[model samples]
Target: MTDRRYTLSKNERLCGKKNIQELFNEGSSFYFFPFKVYYSFNKNKTEGDHCALFTVPKRLFSKAVDRNLLKRKIKEAYRLNKPQFYNIPTSRPINIAYIYTARKMLNYSDIESSMIRCQKKLADNILNAQNDEEKN
Candidate 1:
């Protein structure tokens, strides 16, 4: 009913062999300036909400502190902007993983802008997917 309804939990962080495999195999993707999003619908595991996983590769961010900093920025952006996703119907749930693909660390402003762009794109994608389902 509310945006806070879709926040991710520890168990939904995209672990386990099958979930990881599905992420690689079936996920559709979108790329903003600094982030790449991979998402898929899991009929079996879905409830009335969506969940997310955020990742930053160690290869790109050599320092753990830098990685954690970026992760926090991304999380904050998500927390603030998640109402857009929650506005969608609750009958089906989605699993999304966002990978930070930037080569350099960015400030909070840049991360917030990128997150807004990502959320807009995600909303568009969901609408299109729903339209397609209605057509079929």
Candidate 2:
């Protein structure tokens, strides 16, 4: 059987000042076509585990239904694509926040494609960062 690595929770989310600041200050980021990801390096967290924070602005999605729909799409995409991160060495927990930048809503296929691309970029970044650290 295949093991699952990524999971989202209320407390583990990047909600507070410290976590958010760390992500902005210490973490590296990757941007895909439709999503911008901000992630932070951690030394105390576990390997092969992740939590997500998603934002769908009211400015872009005026109605609650629209915002909720977008959020649901993003979450579903993340859920399916999260296993890709398992290949990276996870010494610490990484906090990832996916901010939607598109002006219009996207279909599931588009979201899924974007998410897969985003996850691959993130994995590449992590691998490169680790390699750099090892070389230094």
Candidate 3:
């Protein structure tokens, strides 16, 4: 699916225990509605770029089924809207984690729009970071 780069590939997912730990411990974070996005950027290179992890907190969602449902919705939203970040004019290879922070479960559309906003904000953040470096 060369034409469809939006497909969530294995490489495009935030894997490995080390990678995840680094993101959580040292990455920057921001909140967008039901999602709390934690991200780290490696601005030296663009290749091997942009991996994501979607999560539903077990503390808020007691049931496994409920957590799974939320994760699926979040994944779908990210997959559909990720192209916005893919085309960013920056050298950073971004690693992000989307953790569902809301206590109540929201339906698909709410999650989708929030995901869109999150991606847009990420793009803006990248642009701002680039601009900051230029000014420095």
Candidate 4:
């Protein structure tokens, strides 16, 4: 049986042009291999909320099928690994964008491993920021 918590629901999908623009403009970003991650901490949101955007640019992947396939793989990797990523206690939601930067295709295992590493780094950053805020 599949766990419902692992499912990527509509509420967890980042949407709206305003929200996307805000994330890119104000978010802190880091690159981890095939992905460039942009993340913004949302003070307006309640605790333990997070939303993610997965984008495989049309410029890199000319075909719709290729872009969709890559997006699917990335989303699956994230959905499975997200529980660990959210273990940090925070007062607000996180808005994250995972932009695919690789030119060549990668297998699922490769993507999943990268996702795990990326999540660790992201958690570190979030903790650091939280500590900084508390110190201030």
Candidate 4, residues 16-135: lDDT per residue as tens digits? Answer: 999999999999999999899999897567764599999998889899999999889999999999887777777688999999999988999999999999989999998898899899
Better of 3 and 4 by TM-score: 4
Q: Cα miss at 16, model 3 (Å)?
A: 1.1
Estimate the TM-score of every prediction.
0.86, 0.84, 0.90, 0.94
lDDT of 2 by residue, 42-111 (tens): 5456653565788888898899999899999988888767666655665567788899989999899999
Per-residue accuracy of model 3 over 1-99 as CA lDDT, tens digit each = 224476898988988898899889988898889889998885434676588999988999999999999999999998988777677876667888999
lDDT of 3 at 18: 84
Clash counts per candidate, in order, are 0, 1, 0, 0
Q: Which candidate model has the greater lDDT, 1 or 4? A: 4
Which 10 consecutive positions of candidate 1 have the poorest summed lDDT? 1-10
Worst 10 residues of 2 by lDDT: 1-10
Q: Which ten residues in a row have the lowest lDDT in candidate 4?
A: 1-10
Global lDDT of each model? 0.79, 0.77, 0.85, 0.89
1-136: candidate 1 lDDT, tens digit per residue = 4426545456546566777678768888988889899887766664755767889999999999999998989988887777775677644778788899999888999898889888888878978887888899
